[model samples]
Target: MNFHLKITWYPKKRKSTISRRMVTFSYQVKVNGCNILVCREAFFSVHGLQNNQGRLKNLQKYLREGRSTSPKDRRGKKGNPSRKISQEAVQTVHNFINNIPKYASHYSRSQKPNKVYFDHDMSISSLYQEHYLKYCEQKNAPQVKVSKCRDIFNQDFNIGFKLPRSDTYHVCDEFQIQIKNDQLTNSEDIIRRLKIERDLLHAKASAGQNMITQLSKLAKENPEEYLTISFDLQQTFPTPRLTSEPAFYKRKLWTYNFGIHDCVSKKGHVIVWSEDEAKCGSDEIGSCLIKFLEIQKSQANILHIISDNYRGQGQNWATVALERSLVRTGKFKAIEHWFPQVGHTRPPCGRDFGRIEKHVKNRNPTVYTTHDWVTVIKELCKNNPITVVKMKQADFIDLTPLEKNIAKKDKHDDGSQFRFSEATAFRFDEGMPSHLKVKYQYTEYEEFRTVNITKKGRAHQKNNPFQLSWKYLKPIPICDKKLKDVMSLMPYIPDVLKGYFNSLSESKEQSDENETDVIDIGYIV
Candidate 1:
C-alpha cells in the first residue's frame, strides 16, 4: 500500500508551571487515503522499523531543510577523513623501494617483466626496520609503520626476494597451479611425473638438512674427533658507502666476503678481499679452505665441510682435488665436503651471513674502504667475535688445473664414473689417497661410489703436492671509469681512506668506459 508520512512540531496542550516550555513532534500516518493513529513504538512495530529518535530527528531535519528526500547512505560516501597519509610520506617509501638494489632472475627474467628480486637475505621487515627507518630519518620525513610500508610495497610494486638458482623451484609452483585448476591435458601422466619430481626435490632438501643435524650432533658429542663447518660466499659489499647522494649513483668497488661458521664452537670466520685483489673463483675458495684447514690441522682428525651447490665456488672438481691434496698431507685422517641440495641450501653460513648483514645494517660508521668492511665483520659479534682474514693477492692459489691432472677421464680403472655434478658429497681419506668416495644422496652414508682419482700409470706421491710451492696471482686492475668514479666520490671518503682510493690502479685500456652501471642494491650471489 502506498503510504505518505508527515511530521509536525507542536506545543504541549497543558502549559507546565516550570521555567521552560515543552515541545514535541508528532507523525501523521496515511495509508490509501486513510489515517491511522498509533504511538511511535506501535508504528515502528507495524512497519518493521527501529524506534530511533536520533534517526527520526535526522529525517525530520532533512525534510525540514528540503535537502534530501531520504537519509543518504553516508556509509562509503565519507572517505577516511581522520587518517590520511601524506604524498611526501608515500613518496619516501617509493624512493626507498626503488633505490633498493633489484635484479632480474637469470633464468626467468624474460618470463616476468614486472617482477624484480632483491637479496634472499633481505625481507620486508628488515628493510623497514633497518633501511627504511634510516632512510626516513635521513630524509627528515615522518616514518611510516612497517605494516603501512609493506602495504605500499605490495600495492605499488611487483618485487620479490630471491637469489639466482637459490630460489624455490619455479616448475613445481607451475605444476601445482595446473593441478589445482585441473587443466592438465595429460592429467594422469603429468600429475604422476610432477609428484615424483616434487617429492624427490623435497627429499633431497630434507636429507641435506638431516645430514647437517647429524653432523652438528656428532661434532658436539666428539669435538676432538670430528669437526663440522659450513661456508658460503656473501653478496658483494660495495665499497665507499657514503651518505652523499652522488655516491649512490657512482660506480663503487666490490668487496667479497667468504664466511665459514663452525657448527660446534659457534665461531664465524670471514675471508675478505676486493675485486682488485683477486677474482672469487674456485681457486680463491680453495685458498680460503686451505687457510681454514691450516688452523684446524691439530684440532680434529676428521673434518666435515658443508656448502651450497654452487659449482663455481665449492661444488666443483677443483675444490675436490684440493681436498684430495690436503688428505695427502696426512693432517686430516678423513675430510668430507657435502653440498646441500639446491633451492634449500641454507646452512650455518646463511645464519652467519644474516648476523653480519644485520650488524652492518645497524652500524653507525660510514664504510669507506675494504678495511672498514673487515673491521665491521670483525666487530660483528662481541661474545663470539668473527675472525676476519684479509686476503692478499698472494693468498689466492690456482687450483683449477689440479682437476685435469688428478681425474683425466670420466671412467676410472674400477669402472666407476665420477660425475661431479651429480655427486652430493665428496670424501678424501689419508688411507685411500688415490681414491675418492662420492655419494649421490646425503642419506647414503654407508654406500659410496669410489673412483680412482690418480691418473693412469701415476703412483700416489708421498709428499704433499701443495707444500712444495704455490702459484700466486697478480693484482687485478680496476677499470679506468670505475677509478674515475671513485675519485669523484673522494670528497665523501675520509682523509685516511683517500690514500687507498688514490692508490687504485686504473686499467691500461678502459674497456668499461661506456658500460652502464645499474645501481644494483641487492646483495648478488
Candidate 2:
C-alpha cells in the first residue's frame, strides 16, 4: 500500500507561497524494508536533532566526559574511548574525576574561571579602567572615573610593560601590609644609635684645656714689675625686686652700698654702690686705682690696663683716674689704656665666677639677705685667684742699637770733633803757673781727659738708665690717706655728670657767652 507524507525545509530553505497552509506532500513506499517517518515537523525536528542540539550537546558531553561526571546519570559516565592514552594518563584522569564531587550542579552565570590573556596593544591605563569598572559593577561600589584610574595606574606602574593583570590590586595589598608592619615595629634602636653618634661628635668638637698656661709662663719669667689689673663683673641683671616694685614701694627704696676686695692682695678691689635711692639708675663702678696704688705705689706706673668692654664700666674708669691724677699733678701727658677685642677676652678668673654662681644657685636662698650676700661675696673673692702676669723691662724697649746710633748721629754730635789731643793739653797747662811751682800740676791733656772722658760719657750708654733716673729723682710718695681720699670722690663723679659739664662748656663756647664760673672742689665727699 502507498502512504502520503508531508515534508518541510529548514527556515533558511523555506519558500514563499500565496496560501499560508500550502503543504508539500510526498509518497513513502516500502523501499528496501527501511522505515521512515515522513511528517514535515517530525522530519525537520529529527534532522535538527541530528545536526544541531543533539550533535552539539553530545560533543560537549564527550569533551567534559573525562573532566567530571555525575554518579546519578548513567549516560554521564566518565572516560572516552576515542582518545588513546597510556595507563599513567588514564590514572591521572581517574584521579582528577575521583577528586571532584559526585553530585553535579550548573556553573554560576556570574562566576567564571579567570583566564590569563595578553594583548600587545593594551596599555596599563585601559586595563586599570576595565578592572575598576568591573569591580564597581560587581560590588555595587562607587564608580571611579577612567581618567582617575589611569592617573593612579601611571603613578604606581610608570614603567608598565609585562605587568601582572591585577597589578593595581596587588600593589594596594602590598602597600597596606607595609604600613601596618611599619607601625607595629619598634625603631628605638636606630634612634638611640643616632643620638649616641651625635653626642660623641659634639663632645669631640668642644673638648679643650684651659688657656691659662700662656699667662702662667709670662708671670714666671717676670717678678715685682707693675702689672695692669682689671676684672669683669659677673651676672649683671636688672634688680628683680626693683623691677617689680610699685610706685609707692619705689618711694621707700634705699641704696645698698657694698665693697669688694681681693683678700690675697687688695689690688683687685672695687666698690659697687647703687646710685639713686631706688637703685634704678646706672651702677657706680668704683675706680680701684687709689686702693691699688696704696697697696703698691708702683701700680701707677702701669701703662696699659686691658679689660672687657663692660657697658658703663670699662675704659671710662681708667680715663677718670687719669684725669684726676692729671688735675692733681697739673700734668697733661696722655695715659695709655686698652680694651680687649670685643668678645675675645676670657680669663681663667671668669670661670671661677661661674662656679660661684653655681654655688649660689645650689644654696637656693629665697631672699638675698645682706649677711648672706656678704658671706657669698667673701667666699667667692677668697676662692677665686686673681691671675696676674707681671710686666718685664724687655716689654718696654722698641729701638735697636743701629736705630740708636742713627738717632745719635741725627742729633749732630760728631765724636771725633770733641776729642782732646795729648800735646795740646800739656802745652796749655805749662803756660799756667800755679803758686810759683805746683807740685805735679796736671798737664792740659790730663785735665782734658778727666773732663771729657770721665764726665762727658754718653747718657744712653748707662746701665738701666730709666730705673736709675727714676731712683735718683725719687717721685713724691703718695700717702695712703691721700689715695683713700681719691677713691671716696668717685661716687659723685658719674659719667653723666661729666657729660653734662662737657655739654655746658660746648654750649657756652657756641653762644660766645662769658665762661660760666663755678666753685671747683677737688673732692666729692
**What TM-score number comes out for model 2?**
0.26
lDDT tens per residue, model 1, 1-525? 656676665656775556354555576678789876667776666555774556776886775565647866675455665456778889999999988766544334336646878888899999988899899888898778889999999999999987644554555556556655557755888878777886777667777877988898999999989989999898899888888999888988889999899998888888998887777778788888878766656468898999887877888778877778777777678999888875554588878888888887787558888888888887877887888889877767777556655864576456866676878888888889768887888875558778886777656455453553454433455766777888899777778777776667433233234344212222244
Off by over 4 Å in 2: 1-220, 237-270, 277-283, 295-300, 316-336, 366-372, 381-525
Backbone atom clashes (below 3 Å) for every candidate: 2, 2
TM-score of each: 0.65, 0.26
Judged by lDDT, which candidate is best?
1
Local accuracy of candidate 2 as per-residue lDDT tens digits, 1-525: 333332222223346555454333332333346556554445445445535545434433443444343234434355775433345533332332233222111111013222222333456455545554564466554444456444444453222233232112233233334433555347666545555654443232222111123323433344233243435544431111122224213221121322222222323342232211112111123223333333444423222233344434443322333322322232222222233322223433355455555665676432222233334445554454332222112212221221232111111122333221111111111122110111111221223321111123355342221221111111112223332342333344445434532433343344343323211112111
Task: For model 2, give the 10-residue run with minimal summed lDDT.
Answer: 433-442
